[model samples]
Target: MRLTPRIVPLLLLAAALLGAAPAAPHPVEAQAPQASWSWPLEPRPAVVHPFDPPERPWLSGHRGVDLAASAGATVRAPAPGTVVFVGWVVDRPVVTIDHGDGLRSSFEPVDSPLALGVEVEKETPLGTLEPAEVGHCAPAACLHWGVRRGDEYVDPLQFVEDRRPSVLLPWAGPP
Candidate 1:
């Protein structure tokens, strides 16, 4: 093909137009807020089951996904935010990070060293998974992580891409 001056601009314009087309919205984008976040687990493990069917006759469906990890594994923050809640829920330390713009991440059965109101970077260490100690979730330790926008829960994996920084657990490996 011989490239002429006139044709070159036209080709470039066509390429630009194609590239400018809006990307398709991610599955969770509609439900998620403007802020971005991600899973704290490294290597992006697959969810055993993303959604749990409603078990009760008058109840709703499962709100979050479960990541597979060994007990005492580290759990990191999925995004940059503030530690909104860090305390023992029935003796199992739970940590909640507020990633502003209405986005938030929550992890149960955490061994968090950060206190409430602490500002954390993305992938910062949140705590470790002590399954044997935490009665609510034991045997095989894993972080029961959840993402919330306002009050509604959304899937965390869909928001952040690649290895973004976040609150980290001591045991978490590189993503």
Candidate 2:
């Protein structure tokens, strides 16, 4: 049976709207939890140095992970959240995004254009990376990404996988 021209467009439109076509199903990779968010720097395997014995004798261990990236590289928010703090710490700007579930992501030496109370989306540019100072780091530029839950400082790398566009490296997954 031949279809009328008038009916053809309507059928096509309906199919498009309903997504009824047999298209290749996108791979069903497990979505990292909503609590899990993006990493600030361009995706790369993390280079972590164990916390020295003198650094924290009381705490369990090193509180955060250091991501290797160049200076002035864009830093993005890991998740959709509110900017709770944006200010200078020892003359270097720091921005903090609060995920509202006792989870917070923070960046140091940032040039933040966003102010406190501003809502940020996942992967939104929070600031640019700054040069690491002497004694703080050897000579390379890197982002010292950190996370805090309530009062306890935990490893930020543990919360989210590398969701950067160029690579898909598996992380330990969120805690």
Candidate 3:
């Protein structure tokens, strides 16, 4: 096939992505290379809202998971990372940690005293959760935890739990 000018760029981009990604036997292996991440909140906080990544960036969707917590509830880091941003994201205080590998976790309405550029390990004390006046779990307080790979929103549950779903790691297939 004769490659057009536009097609050549597309092909080069695809090849670059494949070369950059870890060689996996299957797509799932490449998708989830490791499951070393930990939970952000201890005592396994109840999930008030689940992740619902939108089809588009402008579309409406729940980008993260909401954990049922109380005011002043302890919030911890889910992985070893550097504090990239620690301040208000909108109306509520937020703490964003960069876990390297293009992955980052964010907690909203948190009272984190840590400043940006601080290094933290898994289960490191981030701060306490500040109750929101008009929150997802209103009347009862909760914390909104989010994870992102670059600019793409990823399911936060995958970090805390093994997302293999089935008993076997790989899908059954005929020999």
Candidate 4:
């Protein structure tokens, strides 16, 4: 095919689309800006599972982190953004919050009432972690939280620090 003006742009777009495989790589990754992020679970819940990126784009690996959460624990937004999705992705009821700058967070096996495009702030009550008999944590309920920059899977915890009330020390005014 001749490299025409229209064709050139389309070709580049095709390359980018293929590069964004969550497991693949793209040049736009380093350029895409990121928002101020936080943790979806309060008190920095126990990491039942950690993100394990695949060596190859087609290899199998954990795409997200699983945090230890009760059946009905509240799951909040890690950053201020809009709800882009709230539905089933394969077998689990997932809630996805878009933090803009090509960054988004996905939490699955959750119970939420928020609709699409709902504006939420950091630590906003986005949903409640629901117990499931089938998932990464079978027989035990946990929240599967995943962060992504475009199609590239990124570590959610790396951007957040423990800031829960349980971990902070209260101080009285100096006399």
lDDT leader: 3
- The CA lDDT of each predicted structure is 0.73, 0.73, 0.87, 0.83
Ranking 2 against 3 by TM-score, winner: 3
- Provide the RMSD of all predictions against the true structure, rounded to 1 decimal: 13.4, 16.4, 10.5, 16.9
TM-score of each: 0.62, 0.63, 0.75, 0.70
| Tens digits of per-residue lDDT for model 1, 1-175 | 9999999999999999999998864433223343465568776765655645355635877666667777667788887899999887776778999989998888877778898899999888898866755532356566677778897777666675433444433444479
How accurate locally is residue 47 in candidate 3, as Cα lDDT from 0 to 100?
88
**lDDT, candidate 3, 88-167, per-residue tens:** 87688999999999999999889999988999999999999997786687777899999999999999888777776553
Cα shift from native, residue 12, model 1 (Å): 42
- Tens digits of per-residue lDDT for model 2, 1-175: 6899999999989988889666754544665443366667767546655323224548555456667777788999888999999888775678999988898888876788898899999989998877877325548766666788897776675566543445454565598
TM-score winner between 2 and 4, please give it: 4
Winner by lDDT between candidate 4 and candidate 2 = 4
lDDT of 3 at 158: 84
Q: Identify the runs in model 2 with alpha carbons over 4 angstroms from their true place.
A: 1-35, 50-61, 162-175
The superposed Cα distance between candidate 1 and the true structure at residue 86, in angstroms, equals: 0.7
Candidate 1, after superposition: displacement of residue 34 in Å?
9.9
Q: Residue 124 lDDT in model 4?
A: 93
